[model samples]
Structures are given as C-alpha cells and as structure tokens.
Target: MPEPATRIRPMGRRAVLTGGAAAILAAAGFTPAQAATGRSAGKATGEPTYTLTVMGTTDLHGNVFNWDYFGDKEFDDTQHDDIGLAKIATLVDAVRAERGRRNTLLIDAGDTIQGTPLAYYYARVEPITKQRIHPMAAAMNAIGFDAAALGNHEFNYGIPLLRTFEKQLDFPLLGANAVDQRTGQPAFAPYTVRTVRFEGARPLKVGILGLTNPGIAIWDKANVEGQMTFPGLVEQARVFVPRLRRAGADIVVVSAHSGADTSSSYGDALPYPENASTLLAEEVPGIDAVLVGHAHAEIPQRFVTNKETGAQVLLTEPSYWGRRLSLIDLDVRWSGRQGWQVVAKRSQVLKSNTVPEDTEIVALLKGDHDKVVTYVNSPVGTSKEAMSAATARYEDVPALDFVNFVQAKAVKDALAGTADAELPVLSIAAPFNRDAAIPAGQVSVRDVAGLYIYDNTLLAVRFTGAQLKDYLELSATYFKQVTGSGPFAPDDVTNAPTPTAPSGTPDYNYDVVSGLDAPLTYDIDITKAPGQRITGLAYGGAPVGADQVFALAVNNYRQSGGGNFPHVSTAEVIYNRQVEIRQLLIDWVSAAGEIDPVAFSSVDWRLVADGTPVVIEG
Candidate 1:
C-alpha cells in the first residue's frame, strides 16, 4: 500500500505544522492514546484565544483551468461564475494572506478525478498508472492540500488508477468508512491530527475525520464489489470521532463527501442514507464543524444541534467545479487543566468568480490544458443537420435519439451469434446536459461527448414487457400532473419532485426509452398519477405482452442501481463488454463519417393528458 504523503512529524515545541505527524506515529505502531502524548507541548501562560480558519473545496471534477473543453471556450454560466483550480488558487492565496498562512489549513471534500475531457484523457487515453502524474494531483500538490475525503466517483476508473492518483498527491485521501470487505477494517487512513502552534499557549490539535458516501457500494459496484465495502458515514464517524478525541484533538472537524441532506438516491439498496452530513452532525457528539459535498448545492452556513450533547455543529458546502470555496473559522481558548476547547465556530462560502485565475497555476497546467483542448476539437465526422438537446427533458428530439441509436446498435452488434441475438433490443438515454448540441457540417469529438456527459459504460439486460412498463411508469413521474392542456411551458410540467429528489427530479433521472429495429411508442399521461402514467405501450405496432422478453441496452449507472430505477438492477445482464458509451458514439460517428439522423431517428414517445396530446410551449 502507498503511504499518505500528508503525515506530519514532530520537530520540537516550535515545529511548524507541515504534515500528519500523528499518522506517522500510528504507522510506527503507536496506539491512538500514545500518538496524542507524542506531540510536543508548550507551557501554558494565560488563557489565550486563537482563530483557526479551514479553507475547503469540493467536487472539483478535473477542472484545472477555467476553459471548457466541450465548448472550446472559457467556462461561463448564468451567474457568470468562474471554475477550475486556477481561479481557486487566487482565492486561496488571498485567504491565506488575510488569515496568516500558518493559521489556515487547506482541504478538499471529494470528486477530484473525473468530469472534463482532461480527466477522461488521462484516465483512459493515457492512464496515469503508466508512470505519468495526474494533472489533478500535480495542481493540488502545488496548492498544498492538507487532506481530502474520498468521493464515490474516485472509483470510476477502477482501483489501480486511484492508487496511482493517491500516491502522486501531497495529501492523504481519507476515508474511514471505505473498508476492506473481508477484514471489515478501514482500507485508508481514518483521520489525521495536525498540531497548530501558538507562541505562549499550548499547541492546538485539530483532528480531521474524513467520511465518504455509502452509495459507493452501489455506484461503483463493478470496481470495488469484492475488494472493499463502504459503511454509512454516521456509522463510521461514531467509531472514528471518539478515537480522534482520545488522540488529544482540541477540535474535531469532519470533511465529508456526503451532502447535508438526509436523502438516498439508491432507495434502500444500502442500509445507509446517501446524504448524511446533517445526520453526522446531529448524531455525532464531538464534531465541531463539517465540510459537506456530493449534492453540489451552496450552503453558506448551517448549524445542527447534537441531540445527545446539546452542542451545535457547523456545516458548509461549497458549490462544485471549484466555483466556490468554504471558509470555516473556529475560535479556541487554552487553559492549564483542560487544555484547549472550542469557544465559537462559523462558516461561509467564498465565490471564486470574485478573483482572477492564479498565474502560477495557469502556467503550470497550460500544457495539459492545451492538449485536451486540441483533442476535443479534433474533427471526428460530418453532420447533415443541426440537433439540440435544450428541451429534451420534455420533448422528443433527434439529439437523444442519436444516443439511443448508437447504444442499441452497439449492443446488438456485440450480441451477434449469441443466444440473445434473436431478442429485440431497446435503448434508454437521459438528457444529461441541457445546452448540449450538434451543429451542422463537420462534427468533432466534443460534440458527441457533450451529448453523453457521464463516464457511463453500456450494458445489455433482459427485461419482460411488464418490467419495461414499470420502468417507464417510474420515469413518467418526472413530469407533473395537469388537467386540460393550454400549451403549458416545459418547465411547468417537467422535473416533478419525488421522495428521492425533494427539490425536483434531475434531468439525468428522467430516462427516454426507444426501440432499435422498430418503433416502440407510448404516452406519458400527466393527468394520471405515477405508476399509472405509462399508457399505450406498443412495440412494432402491437400491444407489448406482459411476458414478452427483450434485450434492453442501458448504461452501467442505471444497471447498477443508480437513481433507484425499477427492474433494471435485478434484471439478468445479457451483455457486458465494459465499453464506455461516449466512446461508442464517437467511434460510430468516426466510422460512418456522417451523422444523418434520418437514418435512425423516430419519435417514439410523447406527453398526453386524458388521451389528448399535450402541447409544451418552450
């Protein structure tokens, strides 16, 4: 196993806090209590209070620069937010300067490796395991991170690559819950204790316990099924936080890759809730603050009181893609008998857009950025007409059809001369990016990649007609119920709130199913309730029989219990080539040399209310 690079060592009483010395002691066979006493301490003079600021970023998703590879331009949004570590470096420098460099600690929550084309290029095209340092590791090492929590997406490229990325970092990737399957012991370092020095008072020990989401068991089942298991965040924190306290930590802060909400996307597939950062705060007694992640929502500050201890725990989550940075400030007072105790705590999110890109980071990553830009812009094929997925959430469009077409074709081709070859193939796709579009004339890799944003692989499963109907019914819940249609807007009828998605169902969860060789048509009756919304289901102009079995082409995420979709997870998998769906689309376009949607496009589904076709304006 690779050792964590962030482990600090003791260098007398006036030693500066550079690494995880307590972890080094533990590695040297010292017990938790022994490690606590191993730290050098100074004689306390008076009750002096000091402020410690913890700066945090989460869900960076492979952004090193503000440029978007898919769009071939600098990233911009409705809020004019800036992205990437280059901009975050500027904000970090400003914070370190204002707070004094020695008093502040820099950390991250998770999702560091996979998102943009730069990450994909490194992970797949030229793997970092082949002796090349990952750009994320290089940039983060340059910025000097103390530690980071493990995210569920860290397993996207499998374990070997993850270990390589971990070794290249200057910080430890902490995960108390990610344990070995057989031993039931933590596979990674549970927590790290850092000593913050003071002149006249005793040094403050800050314990950072890293907790990862339990959904990794479901989302990355293929990569870690037999090797490891992920327990709940609250469950593992209960075991580690007390140990951290016993390790003589003056203050305990949790950097969790889970969200502040108590919702699970996988719905009972695992015994634990997916987003349990608040539960960790409310249930765990010793924690003083929490850095939340995974939900990608902005929360300046939230205080959850512990039910048993009556102490308030602070929580904050910076938005994803390095757009925001979380600033958590804690005040601690030193005493003769009791040592150090936290007096007050608060947190807020700082916008990276308010600052300029740090020239140091920009210059360091310029070569890697330019390589990805060139790769994505390289022409793959030509298109006969333009296609857009702006309104694909509520309407049938060729952009999504093109995705299903390529996926179903690939599955069918893979199953040729096999037992599943005779079965009819159906494909399912989701509108991942609302702004994804394919322009007329020559097409590039970025055009196809934008259509399928996730790093999902394709798989084929056998499902009965009844199970297929149930799947469609579950997907139909994405739309809100309506009476007589008066040309309602798409937004007014789409993204209905569900138990899993209390803040409206995301576009990725609203799947659109289509037939490969024939037209499979149906109507989602918005007038009806969920489970009864899917009506007029037919394949090849005839009603689908409940016992009819067909091969369904689906993504690995959906097949592996992502979004809690019905029937698919338990279905019998017929084909599993482990092929990435995005690469398939790009390869198909490259071989064909033209993207003429007329060859495979067909309107297979529509929205209706009381047997009347619903008109969706805009």
Candidate 2:
C-alpha cells in the first residue's frame, strides 16, 4: 500500500476542476506561491483530506489455492506466477494493514466460477444448489468482497446455478446491463453504496457501479436468451452513474466485466463492442475509476479522458485467474459546500506471486480442493497409444481427431431419425492446449478436459458446401503464407496474427474440421493470402458440390459468433442438446472404457504451398 510515484499530465480544457483552490491553481498554470497559498487557505478553513484505497480482482475462475487441478500439482507458469484466492487474500490483508482496514475496499470484476476442475465438480458433480456451498463463494466471502460484476461465463452453467452462487455470496453480484427481457429493467443490482466513517468528520459515501459485457447475449444465449438481456456497457453506465451521484455518492467507481480495448470478437452480432470499458469511462461522467476484466490482459494504469466532461478516469485490469490485484487510491478533500470530492487518483497492479498464500484461505477450501484433485486424477478409460496436440495446430493429429470424432458421432446419433439424419456430419476441434495429451494405457477426466478447456456446449448447424468452404478459408488464415516445401518449425507457419488478434491467432481460433463417417479432406494452401487458402475441399473422397448440404458439429462459442467465423453464426441450427462437449468426451470414454485412435483418426488435412505440401519441423 505504499504510494507509487505517478507521472502527471495536463488535463483537457473541459476537465471538471475539483479539490478547492489548489487544483484550480495547478490547472491554471499558476506559480508555486499561489498553489501553496490556496492549500494553506483550505487548511486554515479546517477542510480535511483522506486517501481511499480500492483493491480489486477479476476473472478468478474458481481458483482457491495456488494449485492446478488439471495437472494435479501446484500451478506454475513460465513466469512462475502464483494463482488463486489464497494468494490474493494475503495481498488484500497486506494492503488493508498498510492503508488501514476501514480506508481500503475489496471487490471483484467477474468470472468467479467455472475454470478449474474444482468449479466444474461443484457445478456439475455435486451441485452447490443441492445443499452445498461453492468453494469460490466460501473463499471470496472469507476475503470480504464488497461487490462483483457479472461476467459472461457466469451463465455458462445456466441461470439457476448462477443464482445459487449469488445466493451464497456475502456481497451482491451486480449486472446493470443484465435486464429482464419482458420489463427491460435491471435483473440484478445495478450499484451499491458503502459509507466509510471517521471519528469527527462526515462519512464518505462511495458508489460502486457494475456493468457486464454485451457479448453475453451471444455467448450464453441458450442460458439467458428469453429470461434476460444484456445491453451495451456504455448504455447502462450512462443511466446508472447519474443515479449514483443523485444517491449522494462522494466517489464513483465501476467494476466492469469488460476490457479496456474497444474491440469485439463477435463481429456486428451485437450493436456494442465486447470490450467497452474505456468507452464507458469516456462517455459516463462522475466515475473516478474502473476495474476492467474479460480481456485477460494486464494494464496497470490507463487514463481515459471523458469526452463530455474531460475528467480523466483511471482504468486497471489485473490479468486473470488471480495472478494480480488492481489497486486504485483516490485522494479526496472535504468542504462545507461539497461533502467530499476526489482531488487526485492513481492506479497500479500488484503481482500475487510476491506474497504467499493466506493460511486461513488455504485451510478453508482444502476439502473442496482435495475432492477435485481426486476426481480429475481418477482413471476413466485407457488409450492404445499416446497422442499429443503439440503439433496439432500445423498438422492433423489424432489428439484432435478424437475430439472431432466424439462430437461428430454424438451429433450423428442424436439426429438418426430426424430429417437431418441423411446429411453428412462434420465436426470442428481446436488445439486448445498445446501441452494436452492422452497417455497410453490410461486416460483420466483431466486428460480430455485439458484438451477441450472451454465450457462450450455442442450444436449442429446446417451448412451448404459453399458455406463450408468459406468457413475453412476463414480458419486457414491461422497460418502465414509460405513459399517452399522446406522444413520449417510449426511456430514459423502457424498462428498468423490478424486485425482481430494483434498478438497472433490463438490455437482455439484455428479449428480442424473432420468427418464422422468419412474424412473431410482439404489443403490449406498457405502460399496464398487469406480468403484463398483453402483448396481441394472434399467429402468421402469426392469433390463437394456447391449446393451439397451437410451437418456441422460445432461448439456454441463458434456457432454463436464467438470467433467471428463466417456462415456458422447465421446458419440454420439443426440440433442443440445443450450438452457440454467436454462432458461428452468424458462420457464417451467412460462408456467405451478404451480410446482406440484407429477407429476415428485420419489424415484429413495438410498445409501446402501452391500444390506441394509444406514440411514443418518441431
């Protein structure tokens, strides 16, 4: 809680000038004498100043300890960063001790449940609604959260589960944008006001507004479609910020489940951009700071100048999975006329690895953590041979083929007696985790779950051959253009960056398509530019006709425009059972008791330069 040094910059012409004569003198480029005199006058008048510290965490994703349920060990990254609420709790206590417990407030920007196996076990295996408390709830409540914004993933397990998780929380789970469809009113608490009291001074009222991403409408459409609606973040902030001011809040802070960047992965499916936290700060007045989430990026401090008022709003995102904590300190001054005003503010992110896990939190959730560990490690089936996804991004591999096979077969069997039964079934699978592997002789739930990391459910969409070709072309953009068939490392050719993905196309965005009963063969001619990479597309060893129809087994993320993939979002939905794809793979293996790649693996696709196949190494 030591005050970090901040570089000062001039505010815009329309900036809202606060904090008595000292701020006005500084803004007007007056001499030091004038500024000091203004400060002395304010002090002589007996005005009091205080620093309020707001600490926040986002995208916790069900982490309670610095443990990896999938790996059955302590979580470790290349950076050696520690994870979970246990570490965050230690950091929180340190901040509170330094800044005074009453002066510091702790809150979270959402994605509380559903990431690790612990969250899944509670949601699916032994549901918390069935007379049990969620580990996340227990950990967060123990840490004393003030409030939390609703993340899109909150609806992944449906509203009932989210409500149960909400009911168990000590603080409110707010979502101003998540509204009742019939009434168009907020479905959850839009904002909450907390008062910090002093012995001799008037109490300071801090208003916390919560706004969720608009993409929830597309991402969790099945869970919230008719029941609720998620409008744009900026739209709801405009309505609520003024209400907070009217409610006599001296400081306004926003816990936004949106990114600072103004971008959307779902294209124009929603009217608003998915990551609109900056826009919210700029367009909404009376907001002093914003705790951003959902992008999984680290932004220690970013100042967005409000267009209308020109007041600078501080924004910070603490990465994801409890890796970091965002701290915003507001320097406020009180006057007889204005109760309290934020005179100055700055933000910074604290690395969770710098501290050890809090013993209290570690002890509190040990039972839940152990249960998940035993569950993920329990053997479900056996594999004839080991399969790895390390090279699956640039080449066809049985590791991913097995996923496609399970998905395609499930869709085919589900539509056996339906009108779409005759349609050739194809399934799409992505190398979600490069380290994912199925070891020979044994396969556990974690093995399959690690391969398909997301909680996306399966859906079958009807697509014409022409549309399928276009979809393949879009996915082929993952690879960069290559000239010769020389040996090349996989990284040298795959994960080509585009406008949407500035860092590079993620493995999850590069899908591999395969057939259920036959091979869906194609050549990704990386020699050509994007939109022209897919070539020689065929099904059942025959060239697919433009009008030929087929059923494509796809995850809800892609089909609901998660990746901005073409055709699939607008295509007719032929089947949707709302069954999670990971669960399907687990069920398939448990029933079969064996994973034989020979039954479904095939060399269906390859990367080619012009007409010759490209040789990739490593």
Candidate 3:
C-alpha cells in the first residue's frame, strides 16, 4: 500500500503551481520533487519565483501579557487557555524564522487599546496623553508591526489619546476612511507601500490600505462629532485601490478593521455598512488579499470572486485577543507579460497556545501590569451577601436590580426641577456578563467593572406606553420557544437565530425593569412567538394606554438603537448625562457602604409555558 498523499497547501515554498496543476498533482501520482525536476516541461520561465508571507493580529484590546486583570490570573475560558501579545510575539518569531525574516511582514487590524481593565487603567487612571509611551504602542513596537488599521473602539478614548498613541508607534497607522470633518480628506495615513526583494531579485512593492468600521460615528458620537468623519469602506477602497496600483504596487493587501459580514444591524442608520469586508473584497479590484477583524470571528481562509473581473481575493481573520495568527502566503514570479503576479496562495489561522509566550514582553510591561492590578483590587464598597449574575437570565435576580436602582435614581435626581419629573420612570438593566459577581465580604472596583463591562453613559429618553411595551416585547425574544412547563435545563433554552451566540440567550439582551408598581405584573410565555411572548403587560393595575408617556432610563448604547431595540433612537431625550453607569454604581455603593436588597430588589416578572408557571434553578 502507498502512503497517503500530503495536502499540497503552500508553506513558505518558492515553487509556483497553477490552479489546474495543483488539483491534478495528487491524482496523477506526481510529487513535488518531480515538478521541480520537470519545471521546464510545462512552460518557458525567465526568472525564479519568490514566496511572500504576511502575518496579522487583530482586536488585541490592550492585552500584552496573557493575564486577565478582572480575574487577576492567566486568561482562560475552560476549553481554550490562550490570549495576549506575548503568545503572538512567539508565533511571529517562529514564522519569521521559517520564512526568511526579509520576506515576512506583520500587521495588526486595530482595536488594540481598549478592552480590559489594563487598557482602562492606562487611558483613564494614568493618562497616556502625556509623553509616556502607551503600553499597546510599546508592545506592538516590540513585535515590529509594519502597519495597522483603526478600530471603532480606538475612538472611545477620543482622538488626542489615539493621536498620542499613534505618535509613539514606529509604523504608519492606516485608516483610509477615517476622514477630517473640515477637509473630507483622510485624517490618518490612508495606505503605506513597502518595497522588498527576495533572493536579491527585483524589488516588489506591496501596498496596504486600512479601512475602519462605520459604526464608529454612532458609537463614539461625542468624541468624534465635529472632529472626524468615517466614510464607507467600499467608497474609500474604490478611491485608494486605483491610487495604490498606479503607485507601482505589485501586491495590494487590505487590513480592514471590519467584519466579514455585509449585513448591518443598524439598517439605514448609517449610509454605509458597519461590517463591509466581504463587500470590499467582492466589489473592489486589484486587491490580492484582505485581513479582516473587529468582529472577533475565526475565519481561517475565505476566497471571494470579484463580480466585474472574476479575480480571486484571499481573506483571513484570526480569532480576537491574540488567540490566533492569520497567515497568508503568496508565490509570485515574473510573468513575461504581467510582470510579478501571484501564481499560488495559501492561508491558515495558527493557535497561540501552540507556542510559548515571549519572555521579553512580560518583562517590558511588568510595571504597568502591576499598577493595574493594584488599581482593580482596591476596595470600593461592601456586600452583605454574595450576589451572582449567573442566574440573571433565568430569574428576577437582585444582581441586575442593583444596577437598575442606581440608574433610575440618578435620572430622577437630574430631572427633579423639570416637567419630566412628573412622568412615570422605568429603569432598564442587562446582565452584561454571566461570571460577574460580588463576594460576601467586600466589593472592589473590578467587581463593578466586571458587572458593567462596557463604557456606556446614562440617558433618560421619553417614550410612549406603546413604545415601552414594544421594547419589552423585543427583549422577550431572548427566550426560546418552550412546550411543557416541567423542569428543564436553562442552558437548553437558547433560541438564537445563529448557533455561534452564547447559550440560554445573550445576557446583554435580557433586560429587566425596575419601577413598575403592583398588579402591573407581566409574564413571558416562552411557548409563543417573539412578538407575542409578553402577556398581561399593564400599568397602575390596568392595560397600559398607548398615549401614556414615561421617562425610560437606559444606557447610551441602547438609546443609539443598539441591540435592535424598538423606538429607542427615535424617542425624545428628556435627560442626558456624561456620567458612566459603572462609575455611578461605584459611587452609590461607596456612599452607602453596603448593598441593601430591600431598597430595590423585587420580583415583578416571571415565565410561563403551556399555562404552567416555569421554575428555574438559581
């Protein structure tokens, strides 16, 4: 018996294979050795081909070490125990060693400076706007990144910090679509061209264009309102791609900080798509490959054929948080007519745990990491009992009510002297993280940060009673359709449209109300369709009138129509504050010195299926 044929995927190989030849090689029992010996038999060749390797990292989110500051330990999700730039630096070194360092290039697809507590500590607690080199900048510089794209989260801390962080980087930060409001020209370097030669042959020019997400305009409206404008990805690609080719670039690659999906959750909210990487590759011409991110999805390799030219564009997106590295290898040779053209290509996403973390990175950022550790561990308040958010999605728990109480009280206090004070107020809260909890003994800043992971501000919007009912109905869609009321696993109650979502509905979408009075109770029937799930929605012991108006307390993300909530963005704003909800919670707890469940915690909602009340385990 003959040994099984090896997969012909290219890995730092200089040999060029036509699409037809690669497919026929295995079936014809032809080996790579035979191809090398009989190279001249196929066609006339003038020069030898060269192999070019491109590596990429995205959504690093300020994670330099493999440590999770929230848990104060090495990052782990039970199944996959890997994260951060230390692991990526190790992988980059291995790839550079395998494929000559001169022939390799490294790039990051943004979202580098704002996810963990470490990032927050640097940006807010210790302002990096000064001359100090940002941790992300220092780490990326150590890894030798050639270029990067701007992610939407990059604007969360405003442009001054972003610009300061950019000045410290050795490479050009690319963002073709991030434009200036006054001039409408690219605010940052739109593209960068790097020239390199392999085997001391003729130099090849590689042009890289970076495109950011359009959702930045909505998400970071306050920070970038009059300073920066974000245009569509496809629009900017059409303009820059031609310029790149005219600039004599042999290979044109795009490092798009956008997702692979073309669909926008905020339909018609923005003129362009928020996640338009697939569209850019399919519509634009002369792009050889694309590195996608900002969606945190794992796409090892995808090939999209251009509609007009029928040319193939290779794409790869490694998983977020430095867990994986997206690698693309292209074999280019001097085509007598077309000059240097890519004859063959291959791509893969390498896991971070396969290699050990680089020790140099751990040593370089140890001081900053230690400071962040001290910042998070500092006590904020005390908790009477251990409050866990694990059951927030399954039951009416005090863990979420605690947040709702703070938000509602803040809004009422702000609207004290205004006409909106007389209106009924309902505060909305979501269980952002399932693992969020406060120990029985004490509560720290990290505990509150874990509970409200995002940097969202508070907003009090005025809504009609009909719109309020619509909001609850939309949230009711989180529950899965059920039949029998018998005991069943809560984990098995997920009914998301896609399988990739978290089980038992996403905690971010399971919102709870905090100000409804008695006999105004409502029950969600898991057995019914989404729109009809919420039954017996009432106010003041009667069915809520459509004309009745009220003030709804919610975060800015939802007020900007996040989570696809109904009529949120269209509602009139009665009160708006720059105060972050997390900060408010910390202040409220600190002033009281302890959490009192009797102050706000109560059960006003329940679940029913088949006319039988459903009981869930706590």
Candidate 4:
C-alpha cells in the first residue's frame, strides 16, 4: 500500500518477475529428478487428477452492513435485499456447497476494512472493546474469510487500528510485496499455503501470494506514507517466486489488489491490459492464476503472457461495490522434482441468477445489520424541498451546495487552534453520485445519504500557490477541450467525453473550491508536460507565482494525489488529520434541523475565453 514517487506511472506496472512459470505443468510438487525421468508422484502408476476451485470477492469496499448511501435504504436485492456480509456469506456457502469442502478456498482481494457508514460510526464514537469488533471485520470473520489481502484504503484508519483488527482476523492476511520498514521483510504473511484434498488422503498444497496495488502512497498518505516502503510489484514478485518455490508450494495463485485495463497482448500473452493483476499473472513464475481487483471493472477472462517469465497467464475480475464475484476452476499437477503448474482453468461470474444467498452467514451478521439500520434509518432531520441529482435540469443544485458548505464547516472546525484555523480555508469536494440535482422540498434521511455514497474522510494539507496550480492542472486533465467551440456539447446527453484532442481538454476536472475572493483560471495547454500544464494562473484577483503555498482541504484520496494528479503528492507539509466528510454532512444536517439551498455557491470555476464556452463535463 505504498508507492515510489509523485509520478502516476506505476513503479509496479513494469516490475520484473523471474523463473520459469511453465514448471507448474511439469513439476507441481513432483520431484525434479523424477520429472526428468518422466515420472511424477503417480505418473508412474497413474495420472494424478486434482481439481481446485478458487472463490474470490474483490473491492467489497466495506459493504459488510446492508446499508446503502445511494438508496439511503438497506440494499434489498432478493434474499433479504442487497449485498452484505450476510448475503455474500450465503453466496459463499452455496459456492462451497456446490464445490464441496476439499475442492474450495475463499478469499477477498482488498478494501475489506473501509467504505461504509457503519465503519465510519464505529471508528469515531465507539471505543474499541474486545467485546465489540468493528461490525465489518466481525461479519467477515463470521463468514469465515480464509485469506485476505490489504487494499490501499485499508490503511485509512492507520496502522494501529489495523494492527488491532489484525489481531481479530481468523485467517492470514497475505501480502508478498509489502515489506516491513524495519527490516524489509514481509510485513504480513507474504503468502500462505493451504492444503485441500478433493480426493485421496494427502491434500495438495495450494500456495496463495497476495499483492496489493502499490498505489498506497496515493490514497493512504495520511495514515501510512512514511511508516513503510513499497517495492516495485514486478520486482517483489521475482524475489517472492523463488521463495515460494523453495517453501514447497505445489500450486501458486496470486490475489492481486491491482487491476486490468484494455491493453493489447504482447506476443504469447500480454499481461491483461492496464491492470497489474493480469501483468502479475504473466510476470510471476509458477503462478497458476490470478484473482484481480481495484479497477472496479468486470472481466470475464483475459489471457496474457507472463511479462517476466513469458509463461501463460489467466486472470479474472468481478466488478467493484459488491456487484459481482469471480470464481476460478483450475486443474493442477505437481511433478516431484519440478513444482506445481496449471493444467487447465476457467472463470465464472457470481450473479444473482441461479445463485441464492447463504442462509447461515446471513443469520450471523443480521444483528450487526439491524444495528446499522437502527441508526441509519432513524430520521434525524427533515427538509421540505425535494432534491435530486439531475444535473441537466439544473446546475449547482441545493443538495450539491449543502454538501460543500457542511464539509467546509467541518474542516474549519477540525483545524481549531491551528495556524490554518483562520487562513483562507479552501474546501475541495466532488460529487460521486449526482444527477439533475437535489429537488426542493421535504428531504428524508435517505436523500442525503443517497447523494454521497463513498465513505470518504476529509483531509487538509498545506500547498503552495505553485503546488496548487500543479494540483489544479492535474484535475483539469479530466476535462475535454472542444476545438472551435466550448469544452462541452450542451446537448450531449450521454456524458461521453473525449479523452484527448488537438486542444487536449480533459473531461474529469470536477472540483468545488469554497471561499476564495478572486476567481481563478489555468491558461496553459495540457498537451505540454506535467510541470508546464499551467500556462497561466491567478489568485484572489492576480497572477500567482509557482513558489506560493496555500492551505488545501481535500478528501483522503485527492490529498494523496490519487487519480494520477500531480502536485498533491509532493506537498512540503501534511497535517495527517482526517474527518469523515459524508458522516459530517449527516451530522451537520441532522443538527441543523432544516436545510437551505442558498448556502451552496462556489469560488472555484472561473470565467472562460471561448464564446459561450463549454467545459468538458464529467
């Protein structure tokens, strides 16, 4: 969960792995001397047939309780409605039941510890007691996660909390790439080998090596920036493969918290596009298959060449947010002399169709689920005006502005007594869930929760006017600049955005900056380099130099330079303070009793040069 520098280019993307991955097919636990003589543990007498099924859930993002921020209600799908530890537990049981005991193993890739209001509420007010585990972890433990890995967001609560949670884990948390800062040894169990025997007396040893995306520095800087270091994922793989082999693993599987993009295949098999999950497959030797996540994309099956060893690679990813689950069925063999290798493999999706949620796991988590419901569904306040996110119908709706105003207030409050307490506080916010806009009229508890779905914490950092420009330029890359016309097509309904252009306006620059006197603008061409993305800059009302700094309040992800933004990563100072923005709004509005649309206005977006110019919409 750490990265090398400010560059968005993944240091792990090209990390090199070593050794012959093909050895799996020949020597999977078979003696190398025996394999050389064309003999395996049973090859001499008979062909050893073994089938292993791997069940994986990735990017649950703390959906342990059945609450939904989007619906402002319990997520009701079918069996008791919506996905939660209960439902996933049910689903996991059906999978194992269908597969039987000897043939199955269940694992989660990452983001298991953070992302819901329950986690938010628990972390802040309720002091941890051995009697009461964080509901999410408790549910996961009840559901019985066999092995799990760290996601970048897991570090949000900082290591102390994680270390506490770690004590309660029923299974090993495997991470091969993450090393201890003190000795560069694996911080957690680098990889775990579990033996499962579908048939016969002695079980086959299955090796699982977990690798989280090395973007930890980007999202968890507040809690984990300097405590540890991360090696290039590829480099770590090379070192670990040899160690895993020496450890007597029969079959090797990787649970990668990274993701895949639509990249072209290189020669035999290219690591499945844009995703290190696929890349991890090809690059690491002796790995039979990969369970992938972090992109939130749904991938059926992608075949790629091991970039490091030129061995074949297989990968699978179910979408994020509990939308899907990926299952891999693989045949493996072990040669006495060589090691373990893949014989055949396939992937299946964990959809509602034909799959019923497990009844038992659901029962185990219901108590925790009900507790969350009691709090989340309680009507703390009400609004008379109807609210919606239909952006096309209107711009800068009341609910939108309300979120910003409340967040700014929290930031200001959190910084009390600090030098920045009175400094011109700039609050940065983005609408993850938006539409036409929040309508004017009676608002329920569900209304506010629906608009802000992500369980994100508020963060503030000190940035220079120069660093601020660099950060803004990075955000600007999200917008697409229209050539002869404005940045956006007024009638373009799909929200489809152009990636790059002769003008090179990125369509993703969606930010709300609060409390600024003079408006601001960036005149530089984005087609230029990173440092030069800003051709011109302004403050309160004047041209600003690069050397100046400002106190910037942003979400945990942005403050860490997530989304490949520049300058945020290189800031000279970080306060390391965190405020749960979503809950703060919930808290603020609940305390306010009534809401007003008049409070939300922005000093963020400045005037443009194009006639009736449009900005690329995100």
Candidate that would win on lDDT:
1
TM-score of 3: 0.90
The clash tally of candidate 2 reads: 1
Residues 34-114, model 1: lDDT tens digits: 111111333354455677888899999999998888889989999988899987776666555545566778889999999
Q: TM-score of predicted model 4? A: 0.77
Q: How well does each candidate superpose onto the true structure, as a TM-score?
A: 0.93, 0.92, 0.90, 0.77
lDDT of candidate 4 over 303-349, digit per residue (tens): 77876577666788877656565767776665566444566677765
- TM-score order, best first, reads 1, 2, 3, 4
State the C-alpha lDDT per candidate.
Answer: 0.85, 0.85, 0.79, 0.58
Query: Candidate 1: TM-score?
Result: 0.93
- In angstroms, how far off is 274's CA in candidate 3? 2.2
Per-candidate count of clashing residue pairs (backbone under 3 Å): 4, 1, 0, 83
lDDT (Cα, tens digit) per residue for candidate 3, span 407-514: 888988899899878877788889888888888878898887788887788989998878878999888878777787758687656444532333334668778776
Model 3 pairs in collision = none
Candidate achieving higher lDDT, 2 or 4: 2
